[model samples]
Target: MNTSIRRALGTTALTTAALLAASGVASAHVSVNAPSAAQGGYTVLEFRVPTESETASTTAVTVELPGLASARTEPIPGWTATTEKDGGDLVTSVTWTANPGAGVPPGEFQRFVVSAGPLPAQDEVEFPATQTYSDGSVVDWNEATPASGEEPEHPSPTLELAAGSDDTVASAVAAPSSSDSDTTARWLGGIGLVLGALGAALGIGATVRSRRS
Candidate 1:
């Protein structure tokens, strides 16, 4: 084999391998594994954060609640947590701070829990999470507000709250419009008859024209 050809092939192979490794690294981050909340009541939510570092070990993590919503975090060993309250009657404020132990090695995962009360009046609620890495990096998981206002991909952790049965499910229901349905059916039927008559007349005109021609 020629020397130049061998060199080019080796370079191509190295580039391909590097691209694959970089793609995997770009996807790695801290994320919530599972979340739970109760309906019409306060619930403690737990988030499992995985910190993966190639060069530096994670020393601490800070999670900020959006809109300063009130929450209390469960304590972990070798870690300190705190909260901030709102002055007005609006949603309260809270935050969770975590510190890794000295014996903790690199690429370690941790868990933090928080308690929040009097959830909003929606059937579902989402908590957009932001994670701060030891290397001064931030990851935000809030994404892609759907058409139905529900995001499936990269969705914020969500809690489903079912409405009470006595809350009159009928009020939530939307009644079908009989007038609109009738109008649609009438338009379709009229269009069909018009098209059929036009087709028949065109066929008869073609037959007469052929006879004359």
Candidate 2:
């Protein structure tokens, strides 16, 4: 292969790799899944936790439920769910402990569900979580989202509370949709394909030019 064609191909390959890496990072995070819900109603919330440690599995997850009137956890097999309450008899936090060998392993994730609310009047709710690994490391996802719209390194999972009737809120939580990460991945993949095609065309043109020289 000629030098011009080889350089074009190399550049294209690098660009493609970068796009794939970005897509992976975009989706790797602890998140909450709830499509939409009313401001002052009840809804089921699912906390999605992904195991990040290669050496250990995710053994436990504790989520802080600030500003919530009440919450009841859904039973998960192989995991024990516990709740912490304050003097007001309101739940302050919920923790799910994995049974022996039941923790989420590397490259895997688990979702813990809870029926919570009398949703507050706020536009959104942030659930700060502490993830514990079998290796004894802890990850605190407690950062509040900033006004600049940039996500933090360990951002607290947030659920957007939309304006709807109480009945709508009940149905909203029943049907969870694709996350922001999925949408981002699709967009990135499309751009990568276009760039890759352009790179291949350039490489072919370069080869033709070299041959005519």
Candidate 3:
């Protein structure tokens, strides 16, 4: 192959590999999914936690929601959830602790669901989380992304909301039956593979045409 065509194929392969690695790293972080509702609306939020330690299980997690009007947690069979209220009787945070031998093991993840709202009127919201490991180590995900465009090692889970709507109904807020962000990540990986394959085919065709000329 010509030098230019060879470089193009090599670059494509490297880019695809980088994207796949990033997807795996992202899944290890504690994240929140907002399926519905915006500012001033009621909705259910899903906190997805993955155990990043190779040898330790996740024992507990606490998510904070300051100034929230209300919150109700769903029960998980082996875990106990406690909701904290502010001085005004509004829910401020919720903590979930696993029962004996029930914590999330390595390479596994769990979703904790909570119904909350009326969210404050804002374009974006953050839900900082504190994760505890079986090894007695704690990690806090609370750093805000700065203007430098570099992501922090333990970035907080943030969600962007649409403009406020009075017609928003609480019944419309539906949490996913399962927490599998892998669906979107898989699509991205497939596209990268297709791009790499196309680049190789084009480079080969160009080389063949030139040889015959």
Kindly give the number of clashing pairs for every candidate: 1, 0, 0
Ranking by TM-score: 3, 2, 1
Clashing pairs in 1: 70-92
* Every model's TM-score: 0.49, 0.69, 0.73
What is each predicted model's overall lDDT from 0 to 1? 0.57, 0.84, 0.85
Which candidate leads the pack in TM-score? 3
Alpha-carbon lDDT of model 1:
0.57
lDDT of 3 by residue, 1-213 (tens): 599999999999999999999998988889999868587787889999999999999999999985566688999989999988765566789999999989999999999999988776778899999999999999999999999988889999887777776554342233221223456678899999999999999999999999999
Off by over 4 Å in 2: 1-13, 165-213
Order of the predicted models by lDDT, top scorer first: 3, 2, 1
Instruction: Estimate candidate 3's alpha-carbon lDDT, on a 0 to 1 scale.
Output: 0.85
Best by lDDT: 3
lDDT tens per residue, model 1, 117-175: 54444677666666565566665656746889743444455556655333333322322
Per-residue alpha-carbon lDDT of model 2 for 1-213, expressed as tens digits?
699999999999999999998877756788998885557777899899999888899999999986455688998889999998775565789999999978999998998999987676668888999999999999999998789998789998988988867565554444222343467789999999999999999999999999999
